[model samples]
Target: MHPMLNIAVRAARAAGNLIARNIGQQDTFEVATKNKDDLVTSIDKQCEKVIVDTLLKSFRDHGIIAEEGGVQGNPDSEYQWIIDPIDGTTNFVQGIPHCAVSIALRHNGKTEIGVVFDPMANEMFTAARGSGAFLNGRRIRVGSRDSLDGAIIGTAFPTRYRDRMHAYLELFSRLISNCADVRRMGAASLDLCYVACGRFDGYLEQGLKAWDFSAGDLILREAGGIVTDFMGEPNYVKSGNVVSGNPKVLRALLQVCDVQNLPAILK
Candidate 1:
């Protein structure tokens, strides 16, 4: 593993273990609402602190962008660690056993390493820029589904941006009509990792944060998948709306989004 990637994996595993131990022990933790319906838990804060501390211990000059803690460390540093300590806080809070700890390292605005660790499942998805993606130390790849037909795609609802719900439903309806099935798994990081490991053929969702998909995006790309915004631009990080799959399935998904004529906010 690349040296930086090794550090990322270590940090992610630490946070993941913290999350796993807290499952079904919600009474021991506290929960709060942020951005209306979005949830954050005390466990989330604890995990973020663990991850940020670990990363900074190794590279204190690097910057940090965390979901709960916001930006920290040297703001002008060329290296930044993007973190979502618990990608499925709701699932973790409810004892659903489906949350993950996501960490990514970016150098000069380009992602160099990604790690998404599901402590409940003990699954570690990892990737370095040029290295292939891996799940539990084994190489992983996207499914070879040629198109949307008969493909099992994954997604998450636009719970944060309710105004875009109608547009999402239209896309969902079109997708369900053509695919084998669709799943709303509640965690965007795991949804993308599922795509990387061929558990799902494609994945899409709107109203996500950089910390939500940054790691998973690198994993999927390293696993031979393509990701873009609804407009077919490599701007999902800025738009917070993402569509990803193997190349053919991705093109098909873009067509469905185009047909919907989604509002400007979603694009």
Candidate 2:
């Protein structure tokens, strides 16, 4: 592992273990509504603190943009850690065993390393730019399905959006007609990781923050997958709206879903 990723892997595993222990242990676990569709728990905040404290302790000059906790340290630092301490909170709260700790390092505005650790399955997905992608230290790649006609795809609900529910439904229906299957698994980070590992041929989502995608996008790109926006541009890192898949299916799926006029915000 690269030195930066080595640190991320260590931090993610430590935080994931702490989170897994607290999962489903108490119905009285405190919860707060970030919004009607979004929820946050004490575990999320605590896990994020553990990760932030660990990373910042050694690299005090490094910047951090994270879920649960906001930005800290130097924003213009060459090394920035983007973190989702525990993604799949809905699954975690429900005791579904699909959540994980996701962390990444960005240097000069491009990803340098990424780590997503799923404690329940003991699976660790890691990637460093130009080094290829990995699961538990072994190589991994995107699926080889050539056609969307029989390929399984994934989607996520943008809990932050209120005006686009019906729009999403319409698009979902159109995709259902063309694709073999679609799944909405409620865990944005893990859903994208699954795409990176070839469990899903493609994944699309909107209204995501950097913490939700920074690690996943790096993993998917390193895993031989192509990721872009509906415009088919490499806008995944900038726009938050993302579409990813193996090359063949990525092209096919974009043809039906690309809304060039929707503006970058709606991408």
Candidate 3:
């Protein structure tokens, strides 16, 4: 295993364990509403602390950009750790058992290590720059499904940005018309990893944060999948509007998005 990736796995697993222990115990912690729909529990902070502390222990100079906790460490540092301590906070708080611990290491602004651990399932999805993606200790790859017909796609609605919901529904309608079906699972990190391991043929979403997709982005690419913005560009990380799948499926999805004449704001 890559050294940095090893640390990432450790951090993710530690946070995952913390999350697992506290699942369904919402009464034990406080929940804060970040917005009309987003919820952050005190466990999120505790998990973030565990992950950040674990990482900083090995690389004290590395910077951090997290969900509950904002940017920390020196902004000028070449190495940055992006994290979503609880990728499915709502699910976790509701005892849905679908959340994950996401951690990624970016060197000079390029993500080189990714780890998304589902504590409930004890599944660890990991990847390094050149190494292939993995679940547990075995390598994994994206599904070979090349077409949208009969494809099982995953997605999350832009609930936080309701202004884009209309365009989102349009895209969803078009996709369902040609594909098998669509799933709106709440966890973006696991949704991307599902695509990486063939459980989901593809996925799309908007208004996500860097912490949400940074780790899964690297994992999917390492597993032979592709990710891009709605415009089929490399700006998904910046735009937070991502479409991902194996090569052929990705092109097909882009085609569906193209005809929508989606508002420029979405791209």
Whole-model Cα lDDT per candidate? 0.90, 0.84, 0.91
Ten-residue segment with the worst summed lDDT in candidate 2?
Answer: 258-267
Mark the regions of model 3 whose C-alpha exceeds 4 Å error after superposition. Answer: 264-267
Cα displacement (angstroms), candidate 2, residue 192, comes to: 1.6
CA shift at 173, candidate 3, in angstroms?
A: 0.9
Segments of candidate 1 deviating more than 4 angstroms: 264-267
Looking at model 3, the pairs that clash are none
User: Tens digits of per-residue lDDT for model 1 on 1-267?
Assistant: 898989988998898888988986878999889978789988899999999999999998999999999999998999999999999888898899898999998999999899999999999999999999999999999999998889998987777777877877877888899899999888899999999999999998887889999999999999999999888899888978899999999999888777447673464
Give the lDDT of residue 130 in candidate 3.
88
Q: Which 10 consecutive residues of model 1 have the lowest summed lDDT?
A: 258-267
Candidate 2: residue 74 lDDT (0-100): 89
Q: Supply the global lDDT for candidate 2.
A: 0.84
lDDT sort, best first: 3, 1, 2
Clashes of each: 0, 0, 0
